[model samples]
Target: MFAVPALSGADDGSWMEVRSADSRECIMAEQRDERLGRRRLHLRLRFLAGESTGSYVTRLAARNNLPVEGVLRSMGIGPMLPVEPQYTEMYLSRYARERLANLAGYTVAEMQKRLVGLRDEFLMSDGDKDDWEWPWDARAGYIVQACSLCAAQRGTRSPAWLILPDPWHVCLRHHRWTDNSRSTQHPYIDLSNLKDVVRAQQRLNRLGKHLGPAARWVFADACSILVRSGYLEDPARTEEWAALAKQLGEQRVRPLAQLSRLSLLTQDLAWLEVRRLYGELGQADYREWLERATRRHGFTFARPLKEWHSQHQPLSRGIPELFSDQSPPSNVVRRATGHELPSCLAAVEELSCLPWVRLPNTMDRLFL
Candidate 1:
């Protein structure tokens, strides 16, 4: 049996007894909580070691007579080991926590207790610890990796994938915000050039804090819809669009904007849209929302709803799902920028949030 080395400078001290057998060096891990529901687990190991973490876990498992998965699970790491670690290390989703018990001197249980206490880390509920698996299920969950700025500041490269209680789009510390881009990853957009957009993000944060999670979820949903409505381009299109644009700028109109745009009045507009959607969505059905979205985008589906796939499906997903707690997809998120938007989202927020209200009970009958 391979024996763990005895501690030299105080058994449970911050500094551990490092015992190297050839090129394999002992890696240490500890949990650091910087935010709610997303504490970071730092693994202090010579990543230069020739072997993969999975190989190390497998070797340890072979040495200890425990299954490789058991070794990882005990450390709060992943289950099915991967040959190479994925880039999604920032959040709770990554699961490679086993390195914390590097010393053979301590038991796995003891090391976990140490991890829980090290950062004064605790969430309201740790409930149903995640089972790390491939092909993640989208209906019930989401995975957000760590903020780039946070990882860079801390010099951590292997951040875990985490399931945040609410969707967060930026690292306020770095003043960098991100969501889905035109590509796969959530690339950070430096907000340094736009002071107003920065204020807008801050206001959104405050709105979330003041109203609580459910309300914030509703508001983000509203923002996503408003951005998609193309009302931002509507003012340039027709007299009807121009009239509404004039009305939005009028003193009598209300201010409304969300993740799509940031302004002094972002908070009020978010709140307004949230209430607006909650009421309208509560009363409206999903079918109408889908059909109206098609008309708004200046297109209509040629086939039946169920037969509609990629092209038409994009227009159909947000409204019904918005009322639910689940996070919306990339199409809905508007990464704030200097681009001009509607003078007031008040005119368009609800139009996007619940377009079903404006539509007739059926699709246009033969253009009659």
Candidate 2:
């Protein structure tokens, strides 16, 4: 039988619940280390989905009324110092992961599913001790709070934090706006009154699913256009977001609140670019289409159309080069030369250098 360590705290019994019904067998068969006298904690906390390993440790410490450092030490994490899960990440060594999984009454596979930092790519195999570390470059991603309502439903007393990826700041279920900043003061903004923002998140989800890898390029290009046009900072362009901020009692609009508008604008711009490239629209025709598309999406370009063309001249000039050496495959040629264009841009690597273009074989039907 596995030995279970007695926990010292006011009894709540919530942590005793198994994370999943299927994990019951795995929990029951947990083993003890006779030599080290290592055992599972009597209270086993549920891991929040997409939770950072550091955040899980924090919640575990809070639930058992133990110091965060103490919990890390118990999991064989050492040289223990203060751990700020919201602002930093913790990478677990292979051995340390085993010990932590044993302590928490979970199998390694079970922990991997819920802990974002516990993935194989993030794990530290050379070291024995788990340590707080970040492996990515300066601005890859950041940790943010998980949905509060979702946490409460999971029976957590303290807030749970998540290592959210780009284009995933909004919690569709709770209508909360989560951000990638280090500040803990306002981790999530309530978007109960902002139905447009909620709809925008849904649209973003669809765009991601529909376009696959190409969605990233579309989103980045859209953001660049908006920033260049001063839509984010210009008062005239930010009226909707400003009103949303005021309703939420914030001094200024949060950039994330404009995601809904951004999503629409992204779709418009992506569709226009595809049409300009594949339809072989003339310069004047392309300019007219660009004007109509931007106006339809409520974006007023700060610069003249000629200036914009000069900046993105490569997109207009590179078509002949793309097909010069070898003609595009029959299907692609048919789609491009036909009167009715395909709903989305074809997945081709040659166009990758251009803004809002997709990579090879990653295309799907876009709604627009």
Candidate 3:
């Protein structure tokens, strides 16, 4: 049995040493012993930013030329059933985490900070007890491949999968686009020919920064409005995304790529509508601004604007209630009360309940 070294504190960084064994001995011992409670692998792989636990483990196993299941099993971690080890997250107990950290030459704190999957509270068990089983039915987040160019820069030849929650997959540095598909077959779309899409992504990033927690809701609302207004389906507006699809050898334009453009065009107006809901702006002023904004994009909002007015006009304007036979529900009254804007949380809750509005699936899965 190989002697286990004491882990020093995270500050001094000396806890990484896993007994001074030579390469041949380390490999032989790791293979010979089914339980690697005190043994460490010969290679110490670095964790990529936002990389999932599955990705890190896969990389570690690949670097050391060992089976991923073997590495996992050796550390007292095993799946509840047969699973694609690289695609699913590994839930770990405290002792399992410490063993993993020791194997990867990272302190527990460092592992928690660097690995995105480690932060999930559901996957983490309490106490010093070493529970080795991964739940078979636990809902796993989608993991997609990171930018190939970025992965190459990090000295990895294999694709690095990440748990990215961003609505769009754009690598600004390489100008490559990947969709939020779980399938790994599609190649990254080149954004060099689609400059508008690139610019829209940049604007979307800025919008996220400006709106903070409300940004996803605001963007979803914008998408819903644009789809309802027929702006996103217009031939002229969709031509760019169609061209991009053709360039990328896809049969059809991805709805998300097209929606990204439409949302960017109308996000400012969506935010204005939010302000109007909060009573920050008068109904008349908001209508006027909406008219100007739509006109700038060569869209006349005559019918759509009128419909919007009828649906959302303040109750103080004496518009008849949708259900005139009875008093409005308290939630409806709360949402539509004049100059009494609902809090952000209330607004989100109300918007989510609207049957006609459809948010992107990604937003629904993640933020909602």
Candidate 4:
């Protein structure tokens, strides 16, 4: 369950897993082909070998007296890979999969089943091979780091990184809807701030029971819109909530607080409103626009998203904007049939195999 150093390419990458065998802790070794030849890598690990939930990077950095990012680069994996771990599969070849299975004690059948399971989870067509890949879009658009609580349950504060394709605020078994990664830099938004949001998340999960994962994108966009309104508030739209924000101020409420307070029926109503109004929206591509818009206006996700969405209640009418704080034009068009056209909200002229993370830009800002 290590995020460590992963490599992403359209093709040509290999990886192996070495687990504790007794704990939830594990390590991943990755390799990518370079023009100079395959890059050699050996993360400095303290203690010859033992069962521990400590981060290999953290320990490796400690052993070699280097920062985690430097150690990752030494391994030929991008420093950002730890934050977006699953991108490794972008270049992970079939040969790599078979090799990894052999190392992890999983049979070929088991590995095939895992791949099949991921496909089923994403509802991708099975017959597409050379042309098939996980729809990294239609997802929360960030890597899933270790669950702090799950790790604590097993006795360690170190990260136990895992993949969460649609982390749409639903964790029935764990009874939590937020990412509890123990990252000091880009930790998750604290869920304890608004308990009602957790309930709303449960309702969203129920919506998923019928609508499936597509509903997740809908709800996520709604939250994104709600969060965006806090910074680039539309006066006409938020007239009703203006007083509330003044009353609660920035400290007393979260931009998403209103979404949490919505009744179950209203939550469904809002989801419907979002689906109908959105027409065609890509939740995967918007955060960059949101981040840039906020930065241009001198605000950060922490400032507004952590404060309040200008609108006190969900709108009954009007199509929601996927990547902007402003409303969409009246003549906005949609793709033919039921297909969704890609969005350039973030100016994706040069699309990379690894989708830039969709979280708020954390480059200089603390929350990406």
TM-scores of all candidate predictions against the true structure: 0.36, 0.61, 0.62, 0.38
Encode model 1's per-residue lDDT on 1-368: one tens digit a residue: 23333346654443333435344444232332222113212333222111222323333444455544444434442223232222111112222232334322333454334323111122112442442322222221123344554554433343322222222345567776433121123244455654555676677667755544334333434444333443332222445324533643321111112233323223433433344334442224344544553453343221221222121222212243444567344244332111112211112223233222121101111111
At residue 320, give the lDDT of candidate 1: 35
Clash count per candidate: 14, 0, 0, 3
Work out candidate 2's RMSD over C-alphas: 12.7
Q: Pairs clashing in candidate 4? A: 255-307, 255-308, 255-309
Of 2 and 3, which scores higher on lDDT?
2
**Candidate 1 — what's its lDDT?**
0.33
Give the residue spans of candidate 4 off by over 4 A: 1-91, 108-140, 152-157, 165-182, 185-193, 220-266, 269-368
Cα shift from native, residue 158, model 3 (Å): 1.2
Off by over 4 Å in 2: 1-39, 125-139, 166-168, 180-187, 235-252, 269-292, 298-368
- Candidate ranking under lDDT, highest first, comes to 2, 3, 4, 1
Give the alpha carbon lDDT tens digit for every residue of 142-197 in model 4: 33444456545544455433333422223444554333233355334445544665
Off by over 4 Å in 1: 1-79, 83-132, 137-142, 158-168, 180-187, 224-228, 232-266, 269-368
Task: Sum up the clashes in candidate 2.
Answer: 0
Q: Alpha-carbon error at 8 in model 4, in Å?
A: 30
- State the lDDT of candidate 2 residue by residue for 1-368, as single tens digits: 11223444673442232233323221111222233316777677876777778788777766766666556545543333334565556787776677778777888898887775776777776753233343332122346667878888776856677764442357888888765443346656777887877887788778766544445555555655555555555422457666655654332244554465578866765554444544455667656765676566553553432333444322443233222445345455334322122122222222223333221112111111
